[model samples]
Target: MTTSIEPGPSRYSFDNDDPESVGRHSHLSNILDPFTFQRLGTLGDLAGKRCLEVGAGGGSVARWFAEQAGPTGDVLATDLNVRHIPLDAGFRVLRHDLVAEPVPDGPWDVIHARLVLLHIPQREAVLARLAESLAPGGALVIEEWATEFGNLCLAAPDDEAAGLIDEYRDTLVNRVLPGRGNDPAWAARVHATMLANGLVGVDTAIDAASWPGGSPGALLIAVNVAQLHDDFIAAGFTEERIQRLYAAVQDPRLVVRSHFTYSTIGRRPGGS
Candidate 1:
């Protein structure tokens, strides 16, 4: 038998030689802090456990987890684009796509996917696969963004540009991205999904905060918005409008807050 498969979007590629791909920028740490370390701490000790970090971008979080797991434990960090994973003695990196390929066999003590589900359209199916990989009494931790248009404020020089920025962001987040609007309810949905997939003891914890001023969180927001200017212009926004929006993002008065939610620790039944 023969099969034909259409190519997916080129979101992840091996060409991670860009300087931005390797840096230890505080901006990323700030944006990921609420979901990553803070929530992971709630999962208790990880030493001597087998852990898997899906979508381990740049392997930063995986590296941190490796430290927590220590020499007695093992960590496997996998990404669609594994080229960005730096050499590490404690962890193994593999290139895997949850949607198209089978997840590696795991009776893992913990399976983690942070800020990753939103990018995959078949989230429920992926959740089922993750559940199958969990060991008895193992945990699955997930974190995703909740982006609402009215919830975000722009600090542009004028109202018109600010509105355009909001529109562009909304369109990209809702239409271009794989998931629906990043709502807080997404946590509940994910928790329910895991429960339906036969996981036991499903629960969620939500964290919300604003990125203000020149903080790293604010800077990450600025950088992502700036990078999307061209896409906004291509989507019918004028160059003048794009520049105006950029300026607005730099305004000190504008506060951009994202609702971050984590649905963590869906344990497998029976502790098999």
Candidate 2:
């Protein structure tokens, strides 16, 4: 799920308030959270740490942080629409607009955002702000998708299904998403940007896997259909074509490459 925490149609393409967003977050969490947790685990035990989770969609990662922080620590999960975040999870939730409002007062031990900053035109500025908010020696972890490698369809129900996947992929990468201000190229730049923002020991890793139909990866495509069918219709894709794409992703015979996820980690200087 792309966590566009700024509300309104003018700010983002996907709406967290939409019912489909729950599935979107779940499918994405299934596919991505393990890797995310692995990276964060390198920071050592988070007991008594103050953590901030920006653009928390379904709050899976925030809940993890809360569990790690325990009763004495603090975890703040913020999004423009916070309806999906659990209230009893020992963390606080806020109706935050990442693009418009100031960052919460955080000299935080850890700050994390996944599938978020690339959607904001002010991403570079936001990166700097996040770096500055970190407590000395605190870590920042950001994850984003890089789709430039193109979808490789290994198998499909038929030639039409294969072609539909390509067409839909192109339309999403080149048209609809960019029109909503998504920068597909930004993931590749996060490492250097973090370095320039005065963070030390910046590192990044990329993860991708085959997305066979009916798997969580393919479920992501189906969830996208529910979230963006209207956008496809507006982009001159027929209703049948949109639905066919959905069906193709659900067919076990179809296989495609998953989007490459760039996970970048950096730390503020001067802390052990």
Candidate 3:
């Protein structure tokens, strides 16, 4: 017999007294910035449509969606953990787990999730839930990182450090995060998953962009590397090895290439 675990309270409810530490640790804002404008563009017009944003970390995307929907439209943002949400007139932030909480009643014109599904082990189940919440003709958008984007390189002369970074990368792509195991093929799989679950007019688009040379990109990459380095050390890698990896990553000659994929705009069968 399969045992079902009761869903716990919202995963996003952080302590009000610890906002500073929480904000510093929250990488969702930086990690999500690159795709914000692009995601909005992909969403098309939503001048007066109800919208749901799942995993609206820090309310960045939620704010954007609220702006697009205007006062006439409503945007409900939900996440397992409630951090800092900017005060906005029409935006409503809720502490709810998409898997457990009933999706707010929606014949929503649009629903979107970005960089959110990678952490979810139950991708198919979540997609099914999102699909069911849609009104006929409603659009569902999902974007995820492809495993192929896990490229990290260091110009350091120390081969040992490079090796360690590689190992950490493997862990990050395969184990550290729950469903990131399917990173490379996540978009394609999601496409099929949605269709299989009864969505129609499915379409997918892959976005590939380079970080090139910029402090913003460099800083973000360095922070991510540092996080991975800490994880590696915790997982038995030596401190020296982690240091060496960071050194190589900081080298000017090493160019890191990341490729991201997105599957946007699947529709519920029948017109709303």
Candidate maximizing TM-score: 2
What TM-score would every model get versus the actual structure? 0.81, 0.94, 0.77
Cα lDDT over the full model 2 = 0.86
Q: For candidate 3, write residues 17-64 as lDDT tens digits.
A: 343424433544554556656655765688988888887656777777
Model 3: residue 30 alpha-carbon error in angstroms: 5.2
- Clashing residue pairs in candidate 3, if any? 11-80, 11-81, 12-80, 12-81, 12-82, 13-82, 147-183, 147-184
Error of 3 at 154 (Å): 8.9
Collision pairs in model 1: 146-182, 155-248, 156-248
In angstroms, how far off is 22's CA in candidate 3?
6.6
Tell me the tens digit of each residue's lDDT in model 1 across 1-272.
Answer: 11122323335321233344443234665567656787788778999888998987666788888889988888888776666665554687777787788887778888998767765667778888998888888889887766533546535445764575576566556543323323333555787888888888787777767755455655554455445445545556567765655565556665666555554668888764
lDDT of each: 0.66, 0.86, 0.63
**Candidate 1 ranges with C-alpha deviation above 4 Å:** 1-26, 154-165, 178-187, 225-230
lDDT of 3 at 90: 56
Which tens-of-lDDT digit does each residue in 1-272 have in candidate 2? Answer: 12323343324567877888888888988999999999889889999999999988889999999989988889999877776777777788877878788899989999999999988889999999999999999999999998666756878989999998888888787878888888988999999999999999999989888888989888788688678888877887788888888889989999988888999999999986
Error of 2 at 155 (Å): 2.1
